[model samples]
Target: MRRNAQALFGLVILLAGIAAVVATRDWKIQTAMYPRVVGIPLVILAAIEVVLSLRGAPEGERQAVDTALSETLPPDVTARRTRVAFTWIVGFFLAIVLIGFPAAVPLFMLAYLRGQGRESWALSLVLAGVAWLAFELIFDRVLHLPFAEGLLLQILRR
Candidate 1:
């Protein structure tokens, strides 16, 4: 039953990826590149998963690839860790919404690396710099994608 459910989920993802790829047909190459890059792989991987799931791939095989922490950790510990993970995810989205991507990207990287990852400050700063540079060069310089200013920025400008 679980295997069948997995296959069904994979099929749904595969269909969504197909829809996204098809929808990008009228978009400019630069505008479509991100979606195409993501969607094409999504379709291929989901199809593969559907095939594997239908083939009765053993649960052990899948578990080896992505073992759940809940299986190993104490329930309380797992719950706490899950909450922390969700907090970081929610904080990331909040940062983006509040400060926009340009500022939020490096800021989030630095905070996550130093806070959660327990990396040295120097390493965090260097990694943040590299991430910021890559984001600027690819999205800003090459693609010329215009990220909308955050609500806070828009309000401040008025």
Candidate 2:
């Protein structure tokens, strides 16, 4: 049953890849470059997955894979972590809304990497800085997407 499910999933992936390729057909070659690159590979990988899944897993191997997949954090711990993760997500969104992109992106990255990942302070700071720079360069400088001032800023002006 598990193998069958995997095979079915692979088939769906294959179909999605085919759809992506078909959808790109009407697009100009230059415009379609990325989708074609991604879609062709997805189709190939999905087809390979389908073929491999059809080859039956050894009895013990399937059980081991299932065990690995099913393994999860202890119930209480998992519940606590889930709550924490949700809180972080909400907090990030709220920060973005209240502080705007430039501030929020680095702040959230630093907090999450430091608090959740328990990464070293130096590494966290470095990563946060890098992320901020990337966001500033790509979305702000290169793309020229206008990010509105945060609500807090807007409110303070009046």
Candidate 3:
């Protein structure tokens, strides 16, 4: 499930990046620079993720991540938690698709922390607040990456 989840997310990213890059194909070279620079790498990384997941783990080499996880939780609990984790991931992706990152990030963070992490409301909110600030400051304010708006927004706008 873990590898499959990774592959699923990778495909999503790859398709989106490819679309962005293709959309810029007719633009001037200067105008195309940003999307190509970002989208090309995103496509490559997503492909890598897909490839790695398909290849499976190396033979005779135990994965440290799996080992650590096993040490932390029993097999049954680990399996249950892993499935829950994947569900959360899919949920977050849906939230982003429906609501846009500006709203989804904090909402996902707060809900995940409170519900899955079983954290206190105050702590969950604080962590979500911190994450939102960091995202806005680093990505939106400083880097100025143009994030795709939600599909719902487009429909609502029209």
TM-score of each: 0.57, 0.54, 0.55
Overall lDDT per candidate, in order of appearance: 0.91, 0.89, 0.87
Model 3 TM-score, all chains together: 0.55
lDDT of 2 by residue, 5-31 (tens): 889998999998999899998999998
The reply for model 1, stretches above 4 Å from the true place, is 1-70
| Predicted candidate 1 versus true structure: per-residue lDDT over 62-134, tens digit per residue | 5565645546877778879999999999998998898899999999999999999999999999999999999
Candidate 1 minimal-lDDT segment of 10 residues = 61-70
Q: Rank order by lDDT, top first?
A: 1, 2, 3
The candidate that wins on lDDT is: 1
Pitting candidate 1 against candidate 2, the one with the higher lDDT is 1
* TM-score-sorted candidate list, best first: 1, 3, 2
Candidate 2 runs further than 4 Å off: 1-71
Q: Residue 136 error for model 1, in Å?
A: 0.7
Model 3: per-residue Cα lDDT over 17-55, one tens digit each: 889999998999999998899989888988887787777
- Count steric clashes of candidate 2: 0
**Number of backbone collisions per candidate, in order?**
0, 0, 0
